[model samples]
Target: MRKIACSLLLAGTLVFGMANSDVEASTHTVKNGESLWNISKSSKVSITNLKKWNNLTSDSLYPNQILQTSAKKTNSASNGISAKKGTFKTKSNVNVRSAAGTTNKVVAKVKKGTTLTVSQQKKLGNDVWFHVKVNKTSGWILSSLLTSANKSTSKSSTASQNVVDQAMKLRFIPYLFGGTTKNGFDCSGFVQYAFKQSGKKISRTTLSQFAQSKKVTSPKPGDLVFFKNTYRKGISHVGIYIGNNKFVHAGGKQSQVTSLSNSYWKSKFDSFKRL
Candidate 1:
């Protein structure tokens, strides 16, 4: 009887340990400006798995929400590979960096429509970087710059192009404080006027426009690009993105086109939005 009791106790302890191990999983605390897509990229987990694990029915996320990044498994079956392999095409001229972040060296520059084989993905900072092979070069590119080869540009592209065309017509116009006309314009005023000309009416001020627009991850032409702490603190400037890492904005002495890669703008870059 003593031997039987000892064996039963050992079996119970083993079962409890196994159950505890099965329940253990990893979690992430959501941050401001983060989305389910962002978390999926960073954690190397699929959005489907994240939703399933956390019992989320929608993609909506709020700051400081604790989410499970992995699921509990009772069996020895593998969760499968985290990285995806696929054929992708560049949406615009893009830089392939030596590493996963923009701070890394540029290994190559590929033009728009370049075909690439993405073998893996890594999340560095707030952006997802894809490890891609083009020609003989292998480097990292921002996922935002590449789209699935099977997918086509959406219908919104045509509407965005119209806005870009309208904005470009006013290029080289002189900049003026609080100006909103063809005579001269401020940054927000320029964007507002361009959208109005494109048949889309948007808010007139940088703050209000930013507040009213929807945040976007993959910004296209005519999307509103915002910057913080330019002449003043907190979302002080705005521009209309014209794609290829460039935007048309009212800045300096005149309205002009500028590159987002410009050190000053890059440092102050906030987020892209769509009206």
Candidate 2:
């Protein structure tokens, strides 16, 4: 009788556990200005699991899109990092960059003692950099400057968004002739930096850039809009097309967002191209 009672108790506990697991599986309706990267980090679910659950083939996500935020079991924590978990804290004042390399644009500076939510880590040379979030900002910080707490989980921004985000971050930087760094930019230099933030390498000059790309008649967001005879003749200026007939570039004095439909730009419009 004792043995039978014990067996019945175990079976009941298993049934309860199964029910509880089902309750944990929940849905998330994506909100505006949110991406799979943002949602995955906040929900502690891996981007891989989020895609798997919702049957997403790409990192593209739309506002009001319904997604599976939870499940009975998921690879949410399997972010390929060997660390026991993803939670971490800054060891010092660390400059977080857009990508894993030091050459990438600095996105944020996390002061010492700040807590960070890690999304993933990548080995760059002999050092590892943790892709982390602090407050609402996300970027990569050297792992040596972080102490993992082994308590959390990770997601990354999509390529197109990354390009736009990087460009937007430098909206007010001064234009420097033949410059390519975040400190300053020329027209083509600005374009190069923006794409590099998304892990895409592009030509360094406006003319070479024009030569490399295939022309597109109907320009889309993320395409390159070229201008002829801005300062010189033929493909001297380029800007990123960001929809709504507006584009961003490092023009005469500084990096600024302008309208493609504006009289000055409209007159010089050569063609739109995609790299």
Return the TM-score for each candidate structure: 0.45, 0.43
Candidate 2, residue 6: the lDDT equals 100
What digit string (tens of lDDT, one per residue) describes model 1 on residues 146-169? 988745445467779999999999
* Tens-digit lDDT string for candidate 2 (1-275): 99999999999999999887665546677899999999988888899988766545468666666677876433435323433236787878889875567886676788887888776676767888777778866667888888755432222224555677788888989999998998999999999999988789998999899998989998767788999987888778999988788999999699999997789999999999987
Evaluated at residue 156, the lDDT of candidate 1 is 69
Candidate 1 stretches with Cα past 4 Å from truth are: 1-155
Superposition TM-score, candidate 2 onto the true structure: 0.43
| Candidate 1 clash figure, as a count | 0
